[model samples]
Target chain A: MSAEGDEAIQRLIALMARLPGLGPRSARRAVLQLVKKKGALLLPLAEAMREVAETARECVNCGNIATRDLCEICADPKRRTGQICVVEDVADLWAMERAQVFRGRYHVLGGTLSALDAVGPEELRIPRLVERVREEEASEIILALAATIDGQTTAHYIADQLPGTSVTSLAQGVPVGGELDYLDDGTITAALKARRAL
Target chain B: MSAEGDEAIQRLIALMARLPGLGPRSARRAVLQLVKKKGALLLPLAEAMREVAETARECVNCGNIATRDLCEICADPKRRTGQICVVEDVADLWAMERAQVFRGRYHVLGGTLSALDAVGPEELRIPRLVERVREEEASEIILALAATIDGQTTAHYIADQLPGTSVTSLAQGVPVGGELDYLDDGTITAALKARRAL
Candidate 1:
């Protein structure tokens, strides 16, 4: 509230501080970094931000984000391997795709089912997912959910709903304390390859 | 030619991949994160980006960025404390300010004067800083540049410019293989307090 504080920079810093790994000071630094590289990076990133701001939408069928009604993976005819990799969120979907090994599609659950916060199936895309499976005649549903209790609970629920459908999960790749974003492509690839029935 | 690519998302991903520490994969996840947090953080950050896109300018005096012709630090009349803390970039200046210790003004050099990249004194804020030393009638000039080779080279050049003016360098509270942006406020405070005369 001092006369010395710069409001605009402060706003930028506050927003950036909320990013997953960045804190206040690092946020300030990141904003400054973007400012410095404005010519090549910042300006373009700014434009992309605007475009995404206008266009980003949820994939109607799978709950992954898309500019269109259906996400690219969902829309792609080549991607229907009769399988759907169910993830806790879009980041997980992107993480699986980043490995470049998954030829199937994805269903982002939006978030894990949590009783602590009272999050339930209706709050997520679970209903839409069962609908997708019925419509797509999916053979397998891969539970790529995190190893957390909530994730496991969500997985079991989804598997139970799809009675005859086989459920599988990525294997032996996620390091302890490592987020999906940090895992290399090769590890994700190996995990996807060695996936076991759940 | 694959059906799984969202053009806009792909473009965003491509652009983000080119950034310093981010790659294509990380960019995808980051974009997803932005999308998920759009209502809370991304929208406001977008607005800030637009504002900065239109209004952000470089401080002619120190090469630090501002939303106006002069940055807040440079615009303040009472901040001219005779001592100008010279830094390699705005991140350094912000880091100094976050410590809430440097009462003096700052002169962001934009970058270290580098001959290897054909960077000259004019490319940096050297000329303006020299002009400032005379204009501001500064007593002690503190070189808070990084300990990198280029940073030291720039520091020496600045020291040589003002023959009679007293100059000093920040003490080694700065860690080896450390960046100013990464240091905690406490470390910055300690470094400034233990500053030694060059």
Candidate 2:
């Protein structure tokens, strides 16, 4: 190998390191595996990434990722139960989808309202969500945002924007199967406050 | 997304999960990030993978990854110092290179002699190593293999094959910055046994 070969491998490693979880060392190991198993892993991965690069786009209606103008959920008429589940990002929407619950459509907020970052309603597609609720005549709006301060603030802002709409949030409590001893104070308090008549 | 789009994303996640440190959940996160940052990360990664897939190959001489028949170290005239360091894998070779300590060349054995896995001398590059030592007139053969039983057996076998060459193993003991209280029993014993004038 020449200097060019070394440069090529370094370039690949640098790119791999920028991935969500990978670092320089792990990237090296991954690159080595990719090189060693060219036919079995490398070529197929390259093709998949290329195909996704060519096709993947966010759904214009819901802001969820899709290959077409509308995502599968938005396209399916059966999913429109006159309810809209709002989330901070597409990843959150996917997490909700994985539970096999939520029989309604979604509105990906893209992000939360943050005074520190100057992120406001316009940046989060709040206007579009309000319009959708009015046009679709949605019965309920489930706020599936995170339990963080920013998440709560965003949810409240959205709720205020859509006055008269029945907006609810995910129940805050101790997780199912979670041990009482390991539960945080906030969770324990919330769970006790929201205790059901079971 | 359409069914085809979903399937394409799934394929990418599966391939990512096969990488060294990434699992299904992390793979999903990585894939989502890639999709989100298409121009910044995904397209460049796809191009890099394609380039590596086309150029990356094992050096015929030393078994290290390279773009050409001979690796950079083997191709360099300055590195032929009559000492050939032996390592179990290309990753180990890369580690040694990163240290920038060794001035000699290398011979990557691919793996150690493992009876459990039915690995033998031919499966590794042991035969090539012996022939190289003779042809290159090597003065020393440094075994930088792991301190495992299989690694020791492979090193001894190689030493026996080359009667006249000076074969040495990496010094084993407490690792640098390792605490004495936390050191393993075997390491403490090795460290005590190999105690020298400091």
Candidate 3:
């Protein structure tokens, strides 16, 4: 294989290896399977990869990914109200929607503030979130951050920043260190309903 | 939403719904996610999908899907060794290699001949397989087919077709009605090397 061919394959392997649960061996197996199923699966996936790589951009307002400059959620006039549900990541936003309980827009913090990792408000999208509240005139902010120490610290920092805004949080249904992806829709719904003012 | 928006979402939902274990609700969630990630993950995936849909073709001889008319395995001189281990599907062929066992070549029999579905050798690549055996002057034909009733029936049919050649089969260690995906690598290697003559 040419260096280019080998590099393309290697680039794919490295990216795949970074996925949540995949390792080098599993990534190789998956790549091989995709190659064999290229007619039905791989080629299309590659095309999708290239297109996303070219067109995908982060939502400037809400931190969600968007094809356009602004994400659909931030652009949609109907979704913008006083209420903004704050989440740690895009996956959490998806989990919340799966519950079919929330009718409000989302504010993805991207990640929590971690002293261990030297992650600050800037790294967590908190500054952008503050701008969203001020510009959009958001009435209420729902903190759906994880129950971990870093998550709590980040939430506290955000709440302090927007002291004038109503702040509530998802209630006691989530287990410690439980990622939103692992929770079923019903659990998410129940947690949203039981949310208390912070 | 406009008709175009609904239609695009609907097409995506349908494809996601057809995935192995996803339901309509999950598909909808997934599509919404794709839309949200369009700039990052969705557009690329769609472009990849379109490309795959356009370029993928199945190997006419062995039923293996490929980028061209013949799969790499079927076309490679290093692969053909007068020994073809028949498998129920592409997944089975992959599982065999995860163990790093099989070295010759593979014939993916799309599926077993089932009386209930009215499937027969004519529906599978059995005819092409017979022709390959004769033309390749196969000395040994190994059946790594599944253990379902239909699998056994197909095996018997193939054994009869290549009566002149030495016919060996994967051993009886496979649990009844079990797909090869669920088996461990050690078990598959043991099964392949200790394969008994029919």
DockQ of each: 0.37, 0.48, 0.15
DockQ of 2: 0.48
**Which parts of model 1 have CA positions greater than 4 angstroms off?**
A1-5, A98-104, A139-142, A164-198, B1-5, B17-25, B147-152, B171-198
Can you rank all candidates by TM-score, best first?
A: 2, 1, 3
Give the true-structure RMSD of model 1: 3.7
Report i-RMS for every model: 3.1, 3.0, 7.1
TM-score of 3: 0.75
User: What lDDT score is found at residue B60 in candidate 2?
Assistant: 95
Ten contiguous residues with the weakest lDDT in model 3 chain B: B1-10
Query: What digit string (tens of lDDT, one per residue) describes model 2 on residues B1-198?
Result: 422237789899989999998987788889989999999999999998999899888899999888888888888888856888888888777766654556788898988899999999999989999899988899888877666678778878888888978887665564543322233445544543443321
| Cα shift from native, residue A36, model 2 (Å) | 1.5
lDDT of 3: 0.71
Best by TM-score: 2
TM-score for each predicted model, relative to the true structure: 0.82, 0.87, 0.75
The residue-level lDDT of candidate 1 at A87 comes to: 85
